[model samples]
Target: MLHRSGSGGPAVVFLPGAGLVGLDYLNMHNRVAELTTTVLYDRAGTGWSEAAVLPRTAAEVTDELLELLRAADVPGPYLLVGHSLGAAYARHLAQRFPGEVAGLLLLDPFHEDLHARVPQEVRDRLKELESQERPSPTEEQLRFGRSQMAPLFASWPETVRDQLIEHHLRVAWRAGLRESENVYDEVAEELRRAPALPDLPLIVITALGRDATQDQLWSERVLREIHCTTRALHADLASSVPRGEQRILDDAGHGFLHEDRPDAVLQAIADLLHRVEQ
Candidate 1:
């Protein structure tokens, strides 16, 4: 767990995406740390954290975070920021324990109904990404992953980048698969049943790679169609909350939108903070 208390204001705790622990957002946390207390921690079995028992449920994970915060005396109300799969956790927290969370910033989040709303082609592309064929990383793949990730680490200091790469290499692929296979769908269902989030400060950052100018291999037209569908979902989500705001980052992909455009991410957080303080 990496936690730093700032001078004042509610603490900000980050929830990472599938296969990544808290350390992946070190740069973002450091920037937020300059303004308020920040907490970034590995879920069990990821990064520097120890292995947790198998079949982790959404309620179990949420309880773990609450226990951690209480044990560490990190007082709330908190600003919960979640990415990808972690966004579900954040929403669960806000709905299940509204008194503790002051606001939410969802970074390129995954909505439960995404599959139903997206085109069949987009759904196929998503299925391709969720392939269960690949489990552990081969030595060559690990080396390649590190090299490809190197440029993205340019903003951080060398020491931090080295540690980040090392932690990335330690990702528990099989465990992640098990957790997702067992828990993600169930969690999404629970969220679907849960009450709508209270009218609190909320910002949804949607990555709309609609321009097809990125270096990705997918054709521009296909990418645009997928992202356009996704953008509509994000807009609907933002409309659900009274104070929710939506920002679309054109030509950006999923997972690491913050790494690609830290300014946009930070601005969203800053905007939420403004509302949180108000």
Candidate 2:
């Protein structure tokens, strides 16, 4: 895997959200590289990274991440930054490899319970991703596919919307299908039901203004993952770890790391890392 690393703080590892070609993290990675020892690696079979028979379980994903870290000489206690599906893997690794990870920065992540509780409307929106041909933007058949399926986001500015289009159009669609379908809910359950989380700093960014159908499910699942009843998942972290904080970014959607409020996103990461070292 190609590794992007440079900042001098503590090494931070980024896990991509089930898409090839991390055009999403490209800008943020370079920015963070200047702030800390940050490493953004394209997952196997994605971006310029070598392909692999991508693993199925969360444990397997964690192991592959370990391999990447070792290969890139990224020393641990790493601050793991994961978005969407990548959040599940990050939580799994944090729990499974307590000694190796120092903190977690989850950017509007998906929790498995949310999947089980998906309302028909949101579920319907996700269905097209499964049913249609996984077409490249080059193929005229999928030309308007992305624009037609805009329900995924509650709200977004033009730049963010454009990136979403690029992802649906330019990036490989098959990988997303594999991730959406094969990406199991069991991993979320494992993280949620853990008897006790390891003592590590955590910063969870939640996107608000969503309602009962999708919002309730996502909010509940994220809360359940932290095992908290508070407004933010970070509050729940204090119950498990010494230094933990949750910040709810009202405007940003699930993909906050690559969105317009990237400054806040990176600040959360820097805050988490600083929290641990102090």
Candidate 3:
């Protein structure tokens, strides 16, 4: 595991979205680390981390994370900032190891019951992914995908953009595809089995782009419905916890929530840290 620590108060650990290494979150990490110690590490099979046995469930991944932290001698009562699928892991960690967690900030998270909440078409696509063997992306495919995502990384420095694209194409894509195919259902089931999270500072940041219609073609209907469903689920999740708060960032997509709205993200962290200290 590759670990980078920044100096300060309580540690803030970042859990990257599926397939991304800790470096993928450099923009947000740099911002958070300025105020507090920050920890970012690659999961097994991603970035510099060596591959581990596959088909790992959320509970298993959580155990591995705890072991990594302990082995590294990183003291906890940590503030966890999890993006996308990582949010599921953060929630599981908090549920199972409440004392170790100080706060939770979930960025555009996937709901444990997302499969049930989304439309049939969306569910069908996810099932298709689950049934098929993970496809290796060709150079042409990678280039095309990167081109489509160009606008998102336009704000990042040239070097960071180049490095992110290289990492995504060469290392993250295949591992992410395997994880999605092998353990998605198991992870969802694991989250379903988790008890409600303990009372703590919680922030659920949801991206609700005003022009989401422009982003879809064949999946327009499914996408619109999914957005509504996602918002509702997050609201319910926030309400379930004592100190939970939900914030919607209009015109923000999943990537832009941290990259574009760093201020909002930092504010949420600041607020959570203040509450924890109090």
Compare the candidates by lDDT and give the number of the best one: 3
Q: Which residue runs does candidate 1 get wrong by more than 4 Å? A: 53-55, 121-131, 170-176, 182-184, 210-219
For model 2, the run of ten residues with the poorest summed lDDT: 225-234
Q: After superposition, how far is residue 8 of candidate 3 from its true place, in Å?
A: 2.6
Error of 3 at 235 (Å): 0.7
- TM-score of each model, in listed order: 0.88, 0.74, 0.89
Per-candidate local distance difference test: 0.77, 0.65, 0.80
TM-score: model 3 vs. ground truth: 0.89
Q: Tens digit of lDDT per residue, candidate 3, span 197-258?
A: 99999999998764322364325676678788889999999988989999998767774467
Clashes of each: 0, 3, 0
lDDT of 1: 0.77
Write the residue-wise lDDT of candidate 2 on 1-278 in tens digits.
55566856568788877653454566677778877888766676655566666446677778888987887777788888888778778888888888888888876666655555544544565665568775445555455666554654325446555565555556545665575576545566667765455777887776553332345444565534332322333345434565666677655544344555778987887788678778
Predicted candidate 1 versus true structure: per-residue lDDT over 1-278, tens digit per residue: 65564656688899987766687788999899888888998777566677877557677778888889899888898899998778878888888889989999998787887767656776676567667476567799889988877887777777667887756665544555555764436777888887789889999999864322233636667666667777888888888999988988874667677777889988888888889988
How large an RMSD does model 1 have? 2.9
Off by over 4 Å in 3: 132-135, 145-161, 182-184, 210-218
Using TM-score, give the best candidate's number.
3
